[model samples]
Target: MALQSLQITALTAMRARDVSRPSREQQEAADRRPLRDETPRRDQPHRGRDR
Candidate 1:
């Protein structure tokens, strides 16, 4: 019974990981793209100030 419960727990953990994995990948992609996009836009004013 303990072994069975352990197996069930493992399966549930795997399912949860699988569900979250895609959203994690999407967040990583958004972070990469938006970081670059936002940096330039934010830097524009700073650059202007320096000039």
Candidate 2:
């Protein structure tokens, strides 16, 4: 049926997305730079509330 086909298509798309996600190491490396940048701000006395 059309609905069944649509469901299968959605499942395939979801699987594809899962497969395309970055590996754990790649994700951690990406996160490291931003965290490093924030560290200095966190250490500062005037990390304003507007952030």
Candidate 3:
């Protein structure tokens, strides 16, 4: 039905908007350290696992 399609479209648009924007905590963390690299280094060996 046309009404169901409209509702689905509205829901999809809302979800897209939500996904496009970051939350307040994320924005604050980004602001605190804008240039720091957060990724784990591949050269470092795992510390806790026993071989």
- List the global CA lDDT of all models: 0.70, 0.77, 0.80
Q: All predictions: root-mean-square deviation over Cα? A: 9.1, 6.7, 6.0
Q: lDDT score, residue 50, model 1?
A: 66
- Candidate 2 residues lying further than 4 Å off, grouped into runs, are 1-8, 34-51
User: How well does candidate 1 match the true structure, expressed as C-alpha RMSD?
Assistant: 9.1
Give the Å shift of residue 10 in candidate 1. Answer: 0.1
Per-prediction TM-score to the true structure, in the order listed:
0.37, 0.42, 0.39
Give the lDDT of residue 19 in candidate 3. 99
Off by more than 4 A, model 3: 1-8, 36-51
How many clashes in each candidate?
Answer: 0, 0, 0
* Model 3: per-residue Cα lDDT over 1-51, one tens digit each: 776665557889999999999999999988888464675557866888657
Ranking by lDDT: 3, 2, 1
Which candidate do you rate higher for TM-score, 1 or 3?
3
**Candidate 1 regions off by >4 Å?**
1-8, 23-38, 41-51
Evaluated with lDDT, which candidate comes out highest?
A: 3
Better of 1 and 2 by lDDT: 2
The true-versus-predicted C-alpha distance at residue 39 of model 2, in Å, is 14
Q: What lDDT score goes with residue 35 in model 2? A: 58
